[model samples]
Target: MKKRLAIALMIGAGLLIKAQVGINMSAPQAILHVDGQKNTAPAVPASYYDDVVVTSLGNMGVGTKSPKTRLDMRSDDRQNAIGIGGTAQTASAAKAGALRYNSGTQDLSYSNGTVWTALAHKAPNDFVDAENPSKQSFTSGTQTIVTNWTKKTDVNGSFNAATGIFVASKTGVYIVSFTFSLASGTIANDSRYETLIQTNSASSATNKVFKCVGSYPGTNGLSNRVAGNCSGIFNLTQGDNITVNLNQALGTSKTLDADATLTSLSIFGL
Candidate 1:
């Protein structure tokens, strides 16, 4: 009787252990079922038991129990979504294909798997209109004369009205041109007129980028007028200065024409 009782207890414990073990399901379909189903025995067709699956190569999938990759994540809403790490200590420390915003400079920087580069802002480009009627007088001999341009219209705020100079805000090639008319009440012989496009300084033989010369014959009683124009394309650097200058050897009384259209300078950047 004692031997039979011990045998019954051992059999009961073994059955309990076997009933608790199961795969692909919380409740045991069998002692160990690779494709455990609710109310059926483990079978060959794995598709019927799609809840959980582990292949021979150790690949696992959550939603897709048959993982193609080592760990394939499949979700309709989470397609191609990558993890975003907000800010980084330095650009060099960031891995390739990383993006971050720089709080110090407020710029967007990106890593190209090699190096990081900050996006640059576009430079200001502009067109400036010269003074309407620049008036000046020449005493005698070769002298640097100023075109007293009082009014200016600038597209990008690059021109100075008080100084009569165009300070370049960007580095590029520029088209510069000036037109002027000279009128003298008493015209004399040997009068020379020169229109000069000067850079950084007043008109001089060394500083003039463009210059035009013409001889004006004197007129008696009538106003003797001489028109001159000069233009050129110049490569300018930022902070460079540009202005139009007049050089004249008018014997005594020669003045720049006060006509708005006749005397003006215009500049544009390409």
Candidate 2:
């Protein structure tokens, strides 16, 4: 080891005169160059594969001979990742621009020096709207779970239009909302109606995310069309499901309805 070190020093001294040293190659392309593969015939390496270099400006390049940043790395057609361990320590303004894995939030956090911001990706969002719309019938004197929804715009494929259930893909805070327009001439002046938004977490009969109720406005002359809209913010777990329901009173039967203007459902992460 001593002999090898002495020889290396002597060789380094010879190269020091030119202020450039190279390993595994006769010509040095940078201040410090180490070619792991020693396949130096191609002139320009492909993204510096099997190569490391420190430029004269003190920029280090991994897998590339030309590094634009302080520490540049490239691996052509290969996966590259940095594994960071979670820490309990808090980040402060002094630590601005620092990065760490936050176990509590299970997210990558960046420090602005005073506070840590979770670098979460874009949240999921979905929307469904009714055009012209259709009517669904239900027996009076009973609460029914509304289903058989066909109009849908589920970008994430997280909603089942036929089943009228939206399943959450991740655990996060979400904003949920739905609007339903009851068919005109179907509701009576003496009748009452209800609309509900239920979730998988609330299994009990009385539990629900939102409930809308209304009574017929007045006798005869006025428009009998009724519409109900409900919205709620919830913290939901992954795979949780949400569905809607309806009920009407004082009529032979009640029909769930919607018009082009007042029917839609939307769910989005915050």
Candidate 3:
């Protein structure tokens, strides 16, 4: 009788050890379940439902047993399907269809399988210089305006003060504009003073992007001031140089206004 009691006690202990545990639930589907849920504990590495799986690497997949990518989420709903926190990087690198945050620029950008573009509606790279040499002179033909613009509001450090050129650091469409007031000595009927937004990569005579002409009507006095502005959008590559040029028809010197608002160059990436 004692031997029979010992065997029964052993059987009871084995059954208790193999029993399923549940919390806030009467029946549990997994070995340990909380409120009929699976893998609620941090100690549990993974969980699965049919082919859908969550892996130890924190990758979750639907309709797949093994996730090939970081997050292989699949859904039929096109609009309300997926959301990502987005990877953060110090600088932009080539990535395909990736949404990421640029820490350097403090902006959000996305890759379109080829190039990375700023996610914001407007351009991320922008600069404006309004302080510089009070006056610049132009002789007869084309002459680069060597204005010493000291104050720079370059957001991306793309503008070079030494060269007086805005070098593109990112490839995109850029809108470049310059406004300057011109004062010439004597006014002739056909005298023309042209302000041009020129790029070094193209021929200025035919491939100039923007030009503004200040024509002397012969009625205006010698001290008359004329404001000229040139603005245009152009597709630019990285390291491309942009500068302002002035061309005068007659052999006379023209002065660019010293006023900050009157003479300035601005560039923005699109």
Which residue pairs in model 3 clash with each other? none
Q: What is the lDDT ranking, best to worst?
A: 2, 1, 3
lDDT of model 2, residue 114:
80
**Candidate 3 TM-score to native:** 0.50
Candidate 3: list runs displaced more than 4 Å: 1-123, 202-208, 218-220
lDDT of 1 at 270: 80
Q: Write the per-residue lDDT of candidate 1 for residues 18-110, one digit (tens) a residue.
A: 563446556433233343344333353333333344444566443344468766545222343445445754555777667875543445668
TM-score on alpha carbons, each prediction: 0.52, 0.51, 0.50
- 179 in model 2: Cα distance from truth in Å? 1.7
lDDT of candidate model 3 versus the reference: 0.62
**Tens digit per residue, CA lDDT, model 2, 18-72:** 6879899888789999888787544555635777899988899877788888987
In model 1, which runs have C-alpha deviations exceeding 4 angstroms?
Answer: 1-124, 201-208, 217-223
Candidate with the greatest lDDT versus the true structure: 2
Higher-ranked by TM-score: 1 or 2: 1
